[model samples]
Target: MNLATNVRIVLVEPAGALNVGAIARVMKNMGLYQLVLVNPQCDPLGEEARRMAVHGGEVLEGATRFENLPEALEGCQRAIATTARDRHVPLTLETPKQVLPWCLEGSPTALIFGPEYRGLSNQELNYAQRFLGIPSNPEYPSLNLAQAVAVCVYELYQLSQNNLAVPPQTTEAARLEDIEGYYQHLESTLLKIGYLQPHTATARMAKFRRLYNRASLSHDEVALLRGILRQVEWAIKPQAGDAE
Candidate 1:
């Protein structure tokens, strides 16, 4: 099965050249191509990476670089961040087989992996609508970065072979940027209404983000929500000639 070209493999702050190189090779093996690096700590195209990549030199060389996760995820409609660590946020950690298939259902999807030492921080994980955790022995559950990427990529490749059907969409799915915009607007409006305070906004917003993400909000849905926030802002504004 031919993998979807829109599926991007994003490595966040990856520090190991060998791991990056091996990830490139496996992506090629699984018929995946797109690779995005976010502020990589190591040289992706250096000799060490090239040596490990072997025949996948093109994939490594052709990788796109971004300064941050949000920028890396621009234009993507669906994203699933892989991690072993848990956070205070209320997010379900699904296995790869369950969530990897979601990437094929949308264009410009992302499978995000965090740095080598620590997994994605809560802030980094927020960029994705879903989270994936590969099942392993409880005693030793963490997998190498390349191994995790390979496992997810292989599942994607296998799913493609079976001719997985894209689920019917009732409405156009919201792009990450669109959702991000809504978040900004929502925060602004909430602050104006005293629903969120400057000191606690970040914590409160994380819960709201999880709520909206779980909804898998469509473009129209986000637009409607933003419109409501706009109206709320307008309602609270002091009109001309109003009492001081």
Candidate 2:
């Protein structure tokens, strides 16, 4: 399978030449390309990186560089940011196994890995629609950036090969944009109905967003719920002193 076309591997400020090269080799073994680097602290074409890449040097050479994360993700519709620590962000999160399918869902997607020393910053992670964390020994759970990328990419490669029961290939599969819109609509409706107070709405909405993202609601379902929210808004507007 041509997994390269579906997903891009993004390295943010990666400082280690060896790790970058290792990642390139692993990506080639897994049949993936499309590498992107954001403000790399080390020269990607440096001797160490190229030495480690060996046969995969082509991937390293063809890599695209960006000064910022958003520029690297311009054509990507879905993005998953890998983190070792939980920041309690508003975005939904999943394990590698849980997120691989969505990553392969026919649109340009990216899996972001942060710097070698510290993982992604909360601000950097904000650009992603979701977070993915690898399950590890809690005693010392943090994974090296290149290792984390290798694991996730390998898992995705394995999933692509299995001729398992595939979900219906319909346009209704709730996309990231659809889910985001629904969350907005739901939160607004809840606020209007006094169920979610302005002060506590953020926390409440986070839980609901997690639920809906896990469920992966269909487009029809999203439309139905949004329509209900619209109706509620319309009904409340008149009572709030709006004529007509």
Candidate 3:
């Protein structure tokens, strides 16, 4: 399979039409066709954007716009997000060379990027399985949104085109929407069992997401886990009244 073809370049809350246009162009140049925009703050198809997209105007016009990251990533099986700065928690930040290859293991994957001014939020970053950070001069670490996308796309193009040895993908991975459903079910089940308090459920679930995402759960694996969660929920269902 042409791995690059399966990769989606997801831009979250992009604020500049020029940036979006440039991103569309670079994606085309790198042979990546999927572009998903999440809650774009600027007009993606303005005159300026068209000028910047140049030969890639079609990519810009054909890009899918989503209301949020989850909506954008619905059908994607694996995703890696770009963060300019390291978070307070110890999230593993890999270089594109290392992480891009792993991304090809899953079908309909994504390489997520945040808006230009401020990078991905903690909440947004949680949606991704892994994180990536490009090495740059520490004195001036920030990279333009489009530039960052370009760099990663270039790396992906080289990796997919060079016929390099890639890890075998035995099973088709489960989609993010399915994984997210499982996560919701798990959280509700855990809360029902008093394993998680309402106030702290978010924090605890983030840990669960990280752990399970690392496993790269296949379709059957996710189904088995969801079934287990469902059984737990059924067992906890009150004989009198049940809360949604």
The CA lDDT at 64 in model 3 is: 93
lDDT sort, best first: 1, 3, 2
Q: Taking the tens digit of each residue's C-alpha lDDT, what string does model 2 give over 131-208?
A: 898999999998877789899988988888883324535654555566566778888889889999999987777677
For candidate 1, the C-alpha RMSD (Å) to the true structure equals 1.3
Off by over 4 Å in 1: 1-4
Q: Give the CA lDDT, 0 to 100, for residue 7 in model 1.
A: 91
* Cα lDDT of model 3 by residue, 156-232, tens digit: 88887785537768887889999888888898889889999999998888888889978989999999998888888
Would you list the C-alpha lDDT of every candidate in the order shown?
A: 0.89, 0.82, 0.87
Q: Name every residue pair that clashes in candidate 2.
A: none
Which scores higher on lDDT, 2 or 3? Answer: 3
- Predicted structure with the largest TM-score when compared to the true one: 1
Cα miss at 155, model 1 (Å)? 0.5
Residue 39 shift from truth in candidate 1, angstroms? 0.3
lDDT winner among the candidates?
1
lDDT of 2: 0.82
Candidate 3 local Cα displacement, residue 10, angstroms: 0.3
